[model samples]
Target chain A: MSEITLGARRPVIVRRRRWRIPGAAIPYLFLAPATLWYAAFLVYPMLQSLYVSFFDWDGLSPSMTFVGLENYINIFAVDDVARLALWNNILWTLGALVLPTLFGLLLALALNRRAPASTLFRTIFYSPAVLPLVAVGLIWAWMYNPHFGVVNVTLKAVGLRSWANGWLSDYTMALPATFVTFIWSHVGFPMIFYLAGLQAISKEYYEAATIDGANAFQRFRHVTMPGLAETHVIVLSLAVINGFKVFDLVYTMTYGGPGRSTQVLGTWMYFQTFQYYHAGYGSALAWVIAAIVLVIAIPYIRRMSRG
Target chain B: MMSDVRRQRRLEQTVIFLGLLALSLIWLTPFATVVLSAIRGQGDLLARGVFSLPKKIAWGNFAEAWSTGDFSIYFRNSLLLIAMKVPLGIFIAALAAYPLAKLRFRFSGAIFIFFLAGLAVPVQVTLQPLLVMMKQLGIANSLFALVPPYVAFGLPFQIFVLRGFFRLIPSELLEAARLDGASEWTAFLRVMLPLSVPALATLCIIDVLATWNEFLIALVLISAKESRTVPVGLLQFQGEYSSQYTLLMAGILISIVPVIAIFIFLQRYFVAGLTAGAVKG
Candidate 1:
């Protein structure tokens, strides 16, 4: 009887102890480092940046005069460079949505068959995506060189010399030219993503579609497209976010050059803050970008959390 | 009719093969340009054009680039950054994730959401303020300036991965450890961590690769000559060797070889890590 009583009481004692604040300290202890880190580097700085957006100050100034969203109004109303950048970003977003996804899906479908050479081809195609943007930007820059670039040389050799122009230097051509390189590097990522999605698809779907007298194109359109909708969400959402935040590639390739024709919000933000010393204006631009990305990203993240 | 169908199918296969081959060739052009240009003599590259075959392979361009290209320092710096950042960041994230995944804590849901929000915030949004903060911290030009931010940025994803993995682990094992009179901490250290090798490995691969090729943070924070990483070094090398195609190509080759070799050797880890969330890991 005494032993039974002791055993029953033991759990209550432990539970009571565990429920106390001191006993619950372990989880908090575990969480502390990450908490401290986020508060210091991520959260605090973000809030600080938002505060700075309302001021009129160079980065080094000893004083900041509060301007009350004047910088935001200024960019929206007066800044042609920002307007141009917004336009280019829209173009980029459209291109990013269509071109890379189309090519990636096509490549993935073609390579989904178990051909012996398919693995090698997949690796080769995926190689460009693995390379540093700095290296990719430079190689394309060199390829677009005017005097003796391979692009021009090949054009001349093919008897279409008139088709060749200085690819990077021409204002109208520069962004598109940069976009071509962007696609070259980018398509492989979505290809890999789609390939993974394709492989997960059970063979029964295709077989059933075939039995229903669906041709290859019809099967692909109806079955494959809906099957990979999750991957489509992941790819398209990421593509849009990356589109808004593009910087390193453009910076390395052209530095928004030959004019500001190729400038996107990212480079323009850098130009405003670092080059022009308008830290206030730049911070406002950053806030706008953050808002746009969050508008797209939060829903996806919430959906992911639900799963 | 069956023989005709077979023949048509074979012809279609041939067409597919030719199409893939053409696309593959187009994909390889930039790599081919970089490799071929790296081997040609600089004078020949300048005079005869980039398309011209080299008189002899200038294999020594790599040697010259290593000594003069500042890549040696940059390479070491990148190596050092990853070495310090990856393991430390993963450790912190893993520790934090354990309680969130296993233990009942107040506000854990809210905390997870906060971390997830970090994913949406662009680096540019924080760039200006971060610069000033680093300056105030008096670590602006040093490698230390990068560590907190890198660790902080990497945490959300890492915690998300680890917590999900931890949740997938059968709770009975942890319960058994607790019933065996082990402390929760010991259960975590021994049972949870040992069982988490694959997830941890996936995180390491992703984190290391990101740090190795990280451009923006290194560009913004570390401007000291000795503190630069491979990407920044390559960018600067471009300015100096803008006319020297062979040398520039050599520099590019040197910078990318380590990462490409790593990817090839650990291709499965890379592909798996990159697609972890999209597919069920």
Candidate 2:
């Protein structure tokens, strides 16, 4: 019995010895490329942004003077532009969250029942989400043109001539008008998401509700709504994040135009950093935007994880 | 009572269907207008209502936009970028994800969580650094500059999604391969990849859509007119012909065709891919 135990133990000892030296190293080999790439590209750049936030560095100029938190202070004290941007960001978040979600749910509810050419309608409805933002922006800008554009022409034909104005250029209407375009471009995405979520729900739930004398509203409220919680959370979070980062559409359509009335944080940051060359101030603004998103999202993420 | 309820449901369904038809029209009208305007000559667009039928169709607008906007070059650039970036991104992501999914490494969870944190970090935050790095690498304003950052920013999400997918594969299959004298690489290549075609197809479709439609990164990175992707090229055309509404619409229509074609062709995979990324752990 002793000799047999020794014979088995000898191989076990050798295997353990082999693991100690090479097993620890092998995983690192797998990790090396990703680790290196992340450090050089992601981590280092983040630190550099932080460092650059303290100095006034015109991206090309050799002269770098540290302004400490003056950039942050100036951004808060004298910049109504930044304030407007912050407000626009809030409006964007609200508009993006409410409009898309409600419209998507409505579309999904409407399309739930079989109809003629339902699949074709569904595809057409979802097509906008696939188009590039620039294409959408350019298309809408043409439609919003003051003369000979589709929107104004339609408004005039409908005898709403008083409402016919340069929608993209008007101070009172530009942001909301632009928001409508943005909403139009993005509504397809949420619609599709909601549709998928709605489809995932078993018809049995609705059937059970029907047996229990539940009407359409009740079925939707209790069955569809609850079934769609995960989709809502994902969509809501994405909407908020994308709202906070609204750049391309604004940049393409209005250019924060007609006296910066349509400015959002992203375009503001772009204007300050790349256009105006206030790198430090723009960095500060970028950080503030990041900080706001982090504050809102981290708690939400934690809540989500717990659930 | 049951018959009455059924009648009411039928009425509600009709109302709902009509409402959806209106909404879908609202959604589709803008795109339809662009397509119509693109095929109509400038005079026809002015003479008729924006949504009215064109008296004369100018199928030449597509060819005009293609030639004048130099879209052939832009299309080629976009195609090249997508071709290179998608495979590179997927390969890197798969390689990175395999160990995270299958290997019993000590820091694998930590590493993965680190990448998960990347999901919240917007590309805007990384733009400046990426620009600087690209400039330093001497590839700024070129297609090469666009590729690396595209891969880098894309890695975390791809790896995260692919890892979730890889985890869903049965461990017994992997073990069987291992028992058959297959090394880890061989096991991953032979056993795992074949099982992952559906997931891969989904990822490929999503990647193609995203990279094809991507604007901001291209806007920041590619400065040369000749090097610009379709989106950037459209912006340039807008600048050159800001008042020429018909021409601008033509450009918009041209730029959208490739993406729409891809979406229609692979819409099932697109829907599956998006939802999987959204819902998966």
Candidate 3:
């Protein structure tokens, strides 16, 4: 008993046999609380939701009836909102990928140099990113206010009276208007990331490019874009993820309304589960979101793991 | 010819400056609008447009937003949630990160990847069952119900950042601690944590902002007014004062002041903290 061998038949020193916890187990000990917490709070809930996805139950009910893949099937076959939501998510992802990434790069390029007030300009651009999205939604809602908002007020001042409209309530303008608000809040995200990426690009690359008779555009094309490749992957991935996870702005501003025109998956899931009381269907949407995210995030995760 | 180049450079600089100024003014316009609207009373705001200056400074709008908006309670609840969740989350994440960063283990890579995978798991995926679980525990309405899920959801990022930082601490320093008869726990507490302050500080900043800004989970789980967080509280403020434009603006202003102050002071830390566990790790 004093001298013991582990499972592999390798003789191991067991100085504290009563404790039975070996050095190998020490790391596990350190990891125990976190692992337990994840298993209980994170993993178990995930599995529970997975189970709930197969059922027909209001979230508050006493008992759940197992309905197999009916909810998943219904999402495709009958749920027009689901299809519209999926389409909207793709639109949001495309919009985010284009607008913010492009504008952010331009801003980063401008502010990358150490000119006077550059930092001040940078601060101004990125400041909106720090505010809560709920606040952002509210701010822009007021900004888009039909009667007394600044958008219309300024338009009227500029003699563009015909352009002033209830942007959020208009069926065609609602989603795009919300997207403009998104651009206002989200451009800073890509700006900061690209800024960091730009800072990391070595001056040697530029020097060599200049020596090779590369003009400004040529040097940027050959050097800067290539340098920011990893950052692009990361930034674009995040933009897509943010698109899938679009909730706060949509919820607080248009609230998937003017008759669900703004209903992305996030808001749609909330409507399904909480409002419509379709717990199982909502869980299915949740899983679908997870699946889509994982598809984008796997490569990102692999990229991160190398570090 | 040299003078021409200098003059050309000066002209280019002027154009760049003007462009930047235009963008800055455009960006600042939203905030300027809010400020203008905040200081004006209801009559003043409705009488004048949002873009106009305050005719009568209703500084009491802030006080009314604070009391009537119930932002005082919201602020307290948010602070309490942060206080409880941040420390507990950081400590637990740090503990796990210590082993994953410095120790030899069979499942280290797999475990790390597993945690990293959690990063991609959207809060929506777990919201339903988490709410059900919270209800079963009978803490669904309590602020305490928030702590577990907050800490849980925060783990993957927290651990990712902390582990990346912990790995950067010289291994020789840890070896020195080991030689000096310090146990793993002692080495972690004394050597690892102290050396990881920059990482911890960044994590603290990140955690505060995230917890403060989080909306949907709080929107779903918290139905009670007293237990409401800042984001939800702001939504309530919006609903109640939808027409009371000045008061709503004041409430929005009050909610953002703390984070904006943090940003202005710690802008460097903010960027560093935000990009901490990103691909560059």
Candidate 4:
């Protein structure tokens, strides 16, 4: 165990004749396949992405110029869409934080008491959350269609014809229109969390609050809010992370725009890398996404590892 | 006084019922649009209105979308990917989970933490380099190229759940098996996996949904028409048939129906697995 003989002289190999393989190596053997996949696909590419970010390389050719910090500087100083995408991500995070959190809690509150046909109502409220984002996005896209869309059709039927603008085409409306679809599909997520959080709250707390002469709102504020604090953390953190990760919905719905007005970091990165052949700039964008996700996700990861 | 109380209760119930009904209808409008849009002719839709009842139900849209939209190939490829990917991912995860959960090793804690860090790394970050690697390896557009990335991305979550389930299993069972001359692999195969079936099933369902709907990686790594999964295939369909609204809606429904049906029937599993976050300190 001496530092001088740390490796070569201190072999602790078990010399049992009955053993074919060393006992100490079994876990590593068990770990080999998953580790290999992660190393090859996830870890290697992750480091490679960082390396590739320092260069001006179209993903196609054999030549790449090492353009030190030009790509990173371009993102911060030069790229208009990059700034817009950053603002869009912040807007998306705020929207995700507010709308889904509020509506999901409301749905959880309304259905928490298990009234008549409550299960069916729960199913209805949650169904949109379960579908593929592409399907969900297209469904909303159809509803938002300028000419024959149901939103315009419904408005026209009600004789508010002028109010029926092209919901997905208008610059101001397009981002919010896509956000509405995000809310529709995602509100159920936080609802399920709140519903579980509500169930986990001991009934005795409510009884005690009632005995203290509290009204429903007071009891909700004092008891229910504190009880669901952990759920709130889980929901808000995940919503923020998914906010950064948002691609499928925006990609499917608006493809980041009528004129890049709907661009988020994810779809912007996609277009830059694949569509425009700006691999270096796109890698920088991807790293930005990774950086944001890591900051939000570290606590969740640490908590998971403690198990 | 009793009669008054009963009247109040009945009135409250009625109000609740009506409120629920209104909410359900609002929540269900998009689905209603899809259902109606899927059943009508293009002319009928544009002529009558978006919400109009079909004068004659066109059952042909599903047939046309299935065949003409190339959705048949997409569905087959998606299902094949799911069948191939989920079991292999879970098996590898279970193997990795067993030692991380049970065996006391020098670096178990560090290794576990390293794997947890993978959870925070976005798949988008891995795409460009993985695409390059795949191209260099000459397997870029093949359906099987997705297997490695999907499995790698799935591992952190899968191992987290399976290891949580495994840790809850009494260590004495493994000790007893070892005393009976069972090797570590035997102890794992015979003692650990069978007890973790519930966790494994939940992982299966979660991975199935993820793999089916996964788009960006598949979109980036896969370019061949024959290898396109459901999500990408439908996107291509939308571009090709921008005017065929009915057919596109039909295509959307056809893609989602199976998973929706599974969700309805297995509602409990979906809730339990999805909400199994690591909030516990």
* Top candidate, metric lDDT: 3
Model 4 residue B79 lDDT? Answer: 93
Comparing candidate 1 with candidate 3, which one achieves the higher lDDT?
3
For model 3, give the RMSD to the true fold.
5.9
Ranking by lDDT: 3, 4, 1, 2
**In terms of TM-score, how similar is model 1 to the real structure?**
0.93
Best by DockQ: 3
TM-score of chain A of each: 0.90, 0.87, 0.91, 0.90
Please list all clashing residue pairs in model 3, or write none if there are none.
none
Candidate 1 chain A has its poorest 10 consecutive residues by lDDT at A12-21
Worst 10 residues of 2 chain B by lDDT: B272-281
Stretches of model 3 off by over 4 angstroms after superposition: A1-21, B1-9, B277-281
Tens digits of lDDT, candidate 3, A222-292: 99999998999889988988889899999999999889888999999999999999999999998889889
Angstrom error of the Cα, residue B24, model 2: value is: 1.4
lDDT of 1 at A2: 100
Error of 2 at B123 (Å): 2.0
Better of 3 and 4 by TM-score: 3
Which segments of model 1 are wrong by more than 4 Å?
A: A1-25, B1-7
Score each candidate by Cα lDDT: 0.86, 0.80, 0.88, 0.88
The collision pairs in model 1 are none
Pick by TM-score: 2 or 4, better one:
4
Clashes of each: 0, 0, 0, 0
| DockQ, cand. 2 | 0.38
